[model samples]
Target: MTDSTHGPRTLTVTEDFAGQRTDRVLAACFGDLSRSRIKNLIDEGRLRRNGEQLGNAAEPVRSGSILVLDIPAPAAAFPVGENITFPILFEDDDLIVLDKPAGLVVHPAPGNETGTLVNALIAHCGDSLVGIGGERRPGIVHRLDKDTSGLMVVAKTEMTHRALSEDFAARRIDRAYLALCWGVPSPTKGEYEGNIGRDKRDRKRMALVERGGKEALTRYTVLKAFRVYAALVECRLATGRTHQIRVHFSANTHPLIGDPLYLRRIPAIAKSCPTDARDVALDFPRQALHAARLGFIHPRTGEKLLFETSPPEDFLTLEKALGSD
Candidate 1:
């Protein structure tokens, strides 16, 4: 049976299969669905032959049976922050800061226009959000990528938002990140200065450029290097540029493993690594990057504030897994 939402389709049961059990018939027609699931559907009266509910999974069905099926619509995803607990790291009359979790998108745009941090903020801040930086993004000072978890500041009023934006534009704020890379850098600790811009070949990606790009500065300190394939490193940004850490590291031949766009091909490192370390590198799911520390003067209060949030679970898990090796 087919309905409008399910689109136009016909479910045909062979006449030769008539007298077969309803579960058997459905299992045959639907490929690999479990018999128990078919039985449950039969029990729910969703499966009817000749417009009559088939109450029993064992009930015999005949050939040419007209089966009517109703496929229920899937429930919409309700975000957890709505009417649920949301951790607030810092809050005041002008702005609030949050330790945003990994996998949470910062704002709505195109395909991700809902179920974002902005959506939750809308619910939490209510009507207090004033447009920031001349956009609908209320009081948003800066952004971290969806997969990169860390501290973020949100403005509650236009005044504070403008102040923060001005500060960021002036390069007056300190932003530091923690990254788990595929291999240790040659220098262990050094500064990488380069220009970053959109890749000419792949518009969706960023690339380090010799010219015609924004100047980017990233300083690195080796936090912990394992005999394994990876190293825990801290990255401090002297200038804010898009994809600064990922791009500079990739250009320097030490891309973060599991980074979807700028993947590290470090088979040798993994192979050369000790047995325990190799196993950890193999299991991580995404590029291990985090905003571990951030310090800035309050746009409203003029007070110096320093905030730090530990890496999310995935980062810690990958760290431990690699450390175990």
Candidate 2:
């Protein structure tokens, strides 16, 4: 019922939980804490009933019994701030919008532990970044692939984190990406709908599967055709799935330029391109995809927010080279 050095939390049993097990009752009351966590606390003698240490988690509890729980502060397992910096589109007390460049990992993972957007955010947001999401991810609301350049949003507060996550799940967020593909699509503008899942043969890759896969949809419009060999296209996501754009385009035989995994061989059209443009296309690194636009409703103010950004210098150079031919 009161705060103390032991991180005490008190609960009073009501008539609704008159004959329930103690652990189940506590789990129902504490929405934020998991049942396993409550059991751990009970096993550690950190839970007390009527000022006495409770012994069994399955024991019955009566109405009007006062229970005290000692919950420890979470360990400092979140990523620390580093001095790295990225382009910021907008920032407020609740959230931050960033124009992330290619090669910048969004968070620390097994093969990547440094020079991530999370490291930079820690340095920028300081202690304010603590515990917005999980300790490992901190304020991260969504993710961008390491090789994909894009506009991304991060939450700085728990309230914003929850709201933004809900918005993404409800498909209320709008995201548009620009890509240069191997060939111009026939219809110029259309939607690709399929179920996407991991490839059975290659666990690391995604595939368009007939069953046991999530529904994925990508709507694309051709912006320009480049001499029948390549085309610039803008894709809008109806459902955000892993590698949705790349996998869908590849499946349709129009893989994006510079895609190492999906684009296995050079298109025949490349042989007809001007020497300079052909060289640029051949030597290009990473996928030729950029998230050009992002739109969502503000969690706190109820205002609609939209953001746009151009691709980085390398992408522009490649585009210019291709356009010259």
Q: What is the C-alpha lDDT of each candidate?
A: 0.73, 0.85
C-alpha lDDT of residue 92 in model 1? 90
Q: After superposition, how far is residue 23 of candidate 2 from its true place, in Å?
A: 22
Q: What is the lDDT of residue 252 in candidate 1?
A: 81
TM agreement with the true structure for every prediction:
0.71, 0.76
lDDT of 1 by residue, 1-325 (tens): 3434432223566777878777787777766456765664554446656754445567677766677655444333332233323467899988888888878888765467567787788788775563454344556789888888888888888778878888888888887899988778878889988877666566457787654456788999989987646789999988887678988888887888678778736556677676765666666666789988877898767899989988887788778877774
TM-score of 1: 0.71
lDDT of 2: 0.85
Model 2: runs farther than 4 Å from truth? 1-76
Best by lDDT: 2
Question: In model 1, what lDDT does residue 118 have?
Answer: 75
Task: List residue ranges in candidate 1 displaced over 4 A.
Answer: 1-86, 264-267
